[model samples]
Target: MPRPRRQTGFAQVTPNLGEHLDREDLLAALRAPDARVENTTLSGLELAEVSADGTGFSNVAFRGCTFEWVDLSGCTFSDVLFSGCRFVRCEMGRSWLNHVDFHSCSAPGLSFAKGRFTGVSFEDCQLSYVDLSEATVDRLAASETNLMEATLHQTRLRHVSLDRCDLTRATFFRTSLEGIDLSSCEIAGIRVSSDLRELRGAIIDEGQAAELIGLLGVRIKEDE
Candidate 1:
């Protein structure tokens, strides 16, 4: 099989949305088993503790919506756009996302473990403490996002870009960073394996190199 195409730039998502749906209609659609909500737009809705597992959303746009403690595990999202949305403690494990774009969203403590992502991009999002463990990610781009203290253990990433993102104290156990660039991102206090093998073949600036060196109990002194 041919290799997957690399995603070099930001995600270009053009949702083919149709009629606007109110909160009641949206909730009703989500209640159905293996639901597939298509071509709809829902905005400015505040939902809490919603259980909508195994649902699929296609060509949907959610603007300024707030989701708290929502369970959306095993869900599928394709060609979906989330703008200015807030997801607090949302459970999205084992979900599959394709061609999804999250713009200016705040998703602190959002759990996406064991998920599969393709052609996804997050721009100007606050994703602190997000969980992405054991996830398979391809063609993903994250720009100006705050991923501080996020979990990425055992995650498989291909053609992923993290531009100007804050990865402070993020854990990456058993995850490889080969061919990934962290020059513009803040990677202070990132956690990895003791052998430091995860950082092999990864691109970083001089300052980042110094920080990694410090992890190996080595200090660099400037020339007199």
Candidate 2:
């Protein structure tokens, strides 16, 4: 993919991708791992795969930033807004996210294994084949999002709302959906079992609904 045009904003330049960026630059700017960067805007900043696991950044804003193949696993963020950001095949395993909002972002094949999330929302984003296995999520909301062929193995989803989202060919092996609300998501070729009661609020097509019903003890009557 071609790089986006450089825009001016409050961001420090770091090394190219695959290289480690200096942490001093970020520290000198008083951008602590636990700092609150609310309402500030950052654009056109390309940094290397940072290893700032457990770093906390709240209320920061990212616009048009390209994070091509960055390893941002286990980073903590809250109330951060990301618009027009491209995270092509980035690794974000086990990241701690809270109240983060994403709009118009493409994050195909992004990894969030064993991560902890709360109040996270995604709108108009493409999340094809994303891996969110073993992640702990709370109050997760997705609207008009694409989640084709995503994996959610052993993930704990409590109070998650999927509205008008595509879940074609998604796999949910051993994933708990006790309080998840999939009322508005397309449930085509989705895998689930009888014990998973979260399907109460899940929306599905006729074929998909039949599959779920089969898992239960109910059988559809055929025309004689």
Candidate 3:
């Protein structure tokens, strides 16, 4: 038997500043009712065990921040940069990350279902178990990133460049992967389409070779 997933704690938490102070000193601030942060630079801060919902964060630089077991549902972030940040068991359903750059971040079990991202760059990031199902994005570039076990069902990926990314065990049900390169990627257990041969320019390795040969009407037998 496995434990069921619990809702993030930030849903019931909020940031409270006991004394009037700047955003840096506000790290010690208690949880607020809504936890709305604006125009704040919370760089290199460790935010743990907080579940946030409907929180609006804009123009924030969250470099090297550690967020664990956090939920950011319906939150809107713009011009935000998360460099060297780590997110563990984070839930960000329906959140909007417009023009946000997540550089050098490693996140596992990060859910962003039905979210919208525009002009976002996921450079050198590890995105495992990150669900982007039915999500919409524009100009999203993921360079030197790993997307192992990531779900991208029915997601719109236009003008998205996944250069040098690892896509092992990634799911792409009913998704269009035209004009995308996967040659520098690992696609073991990847869910693709019949026209995935068009992505031969992007996929690399023996597994893809075998699959592509099979798609090309070539048969390989144990005894030739």
Candidate 4:
């Protein structure tokens, strides 16, 4: 299969959403054997512990919604936009997201292992303890996001850029980060999980280099 095209830049998303729902019918959808909600707009609702595994969401807009411990594994989201949504410990592993935009969303402890993201942008989101291990990402832009304790093992990050994202305690094993710049991101205690050779051609600032100095087998000494 041919490689997906790289993203040049993200376009501003302006959704002319349909229906203004104060409360989502999401609870009813979850009770079904397999829920698939399409072309809906959900906002300002709390989806607590709902399960939508293997569900499909198309042309959906979720704004200011809070998903608490929701099981959304194996779900497919296409043309979905989430702004200011809070996802706490939500399970979304192996989900496929196409043309999804998550602006200012907080998704702590969310698992998206082996998920495929195409034309996705996660701007100003909080993604702590998130798992993207063995995932395939094409054209993903994550700017000003917090990715603390996240793991991206053997993941393919093609045309991905993470600007000013906090990567504290994050692990990158067998992941190619070449041509990616980490000058403005926080990498405190970030584990390579492999040899430092994977970071070749990656850009980092002087401060970040100082932190990784020990990894290069260079010892810091007191000034004489």
Best by lDDT: 1
- Clash count (model 4, backbone only): 0
For candidate 4, write residues 1-224 as lDDT tens digits.
Answer: 76334333343334577753335466666566567777778878788867774777777888898999888888888888888999987888889988888888999888989899888888888898889999999988888889999998899988878777899989887888898888878988888844686577789998888888877678778799
Candidate with the larger TM-score of 1 and 3: 1
Off by over 4 Å in 1: 1-18
Alpha carbon deviation, residue 196, candidate 2 (Å): 6.9
Between candidates 2 and 4, the one scoring higher on TM-score is 4
lDDT for each residue of candidate 2 in 111-203, tens digit (9 for 90 to 100): 998998887888889999999998998878788889999999888888777767898878888776555556557776676655655455554
Model 2 quality (TM-score): 0.73
Local distance difference test values of all predictions, in order: 0.88, 0.70, 0.71, 0.81
How does residue 30 of candidate 2 score in lDDT?
A: 33
* Residue 207 local lDDT, model 4: 82
lDDT of 4 at 145: 86
**Candidate 3 regions with alpha-carbon error over 4 angstroms:** 1-36, 193-211, 214-224
- How high is each candidate's TM-score? 0.92, 0.73, 0.75, 0.86
User: RMSD in angstroms, all models?
Assistant: 4.8, 8.5, 9.9, 5.5
Given candidate 4, what's the lDDT at residue 77? 85
Query: Which candidate model has the greater TM-score, 3 or 4?
Result: 4
